[model samples]
Target: MSTPELQWFKSSYSSSNEPGDCVEVATTPTAVHIRDSKTPRTAQLKITPSAWARFLTTLPT
Candidate 1:
């Protein structure tokens, strides 16, 4: 079986000058996927879009 491709994007908050420290994201209608920018081939964390929204709400200012 062949693995499907996903479009990943690094967080805008991540400094552009340093490409090493960032988290990549890929979103679909069903879920939001995340992975370390330093390691793209590894397993990504998959979460529902609602869950992702809730998570972001908890971020400290």
Candidate 2:
């Protein structure tokens, strides 16, 4: 299957001008996608709904 085309965006909390440390994220209907900005050709990590919520909860409010 071909890779899905998505509008990748960096997290608002991210503060990196260099692409090496940049992470790009995109949202899909059933998952949240995360990929290294420097390696777009590599595989992306997909997080489930519940896990995504918990991950956000761990972040500072």
Candidate 3:
């Protein structure tokens, strides 16, 4: 089986003034994908949903 193409979107927190300094994300049933918005065709990072949640908790709000 093959996975479908990911639907990437820029981060909500991305500054409109700094378009090149942004990140994009896509979510699948098993993993979350992250990549630089300026370089979508480059390599991306993948992590489990649970791991993503843990990472979010570590961020300062």
Candidate 4:
């Protein structure tokens, strides 16, 4: 019916010096939710756990 409420937290990678440029994450057993901290009301993306893993692997170290 409806999605369960998730506890959101800001990413540590978001530099404290740049509070305006940040992202928030909310995780569930089935998917991960991502949203912009600056404009959260605009849109959000949900990705499967596997897809999230693949995306993470592509990021620079």
Flag regions of model 2 displaced more than 4 Å.
1-4
Q: Relative to the unseen true structure, what is the C-alpha lDDT of residue 42 in candidate 3, on a scale of 0 to 100?
A: 92
Question: Scored by CA lDDT, what does every candidate get?
Answer: 0.91, 0.83, 0.91, 0.88
What TM-score does structure 3 among the candidates reach?
0.87
Clashing pairs in 1: none
Backbone clashes, each candidate:
0, 0, 0, 0
Error of 1 at 15 (Å): 0.6
55, model 4: CA deviation in Å? Answer: 0.3
Per-residue CA lDDT of candidate 4, range 1-61, in tens? 9967888889778798988798898889999999998998779999999898998899999
The segments of candidate 1 whose C-alpha lies over 4 angstroms from its true place after superposition are 1-4
TM-score of each: 0.85, 0.71, 0.87, 0.83
Give the C-alpha miss distance for residue 33 in model 2, angstroms: 0.7
What range of 10 consecutive residues in model 1 has the weakest lDDT sum? Answer: 3-12
Residue 45 alpha-carbon offset, candidate 2, angstroms = 0.5
Worst 10 residues of 4 by lDDT: 3-12
Sorted on TM-score, best first, the list reads 3, 1, 4, 2
lDDT of 3 at 26: 95
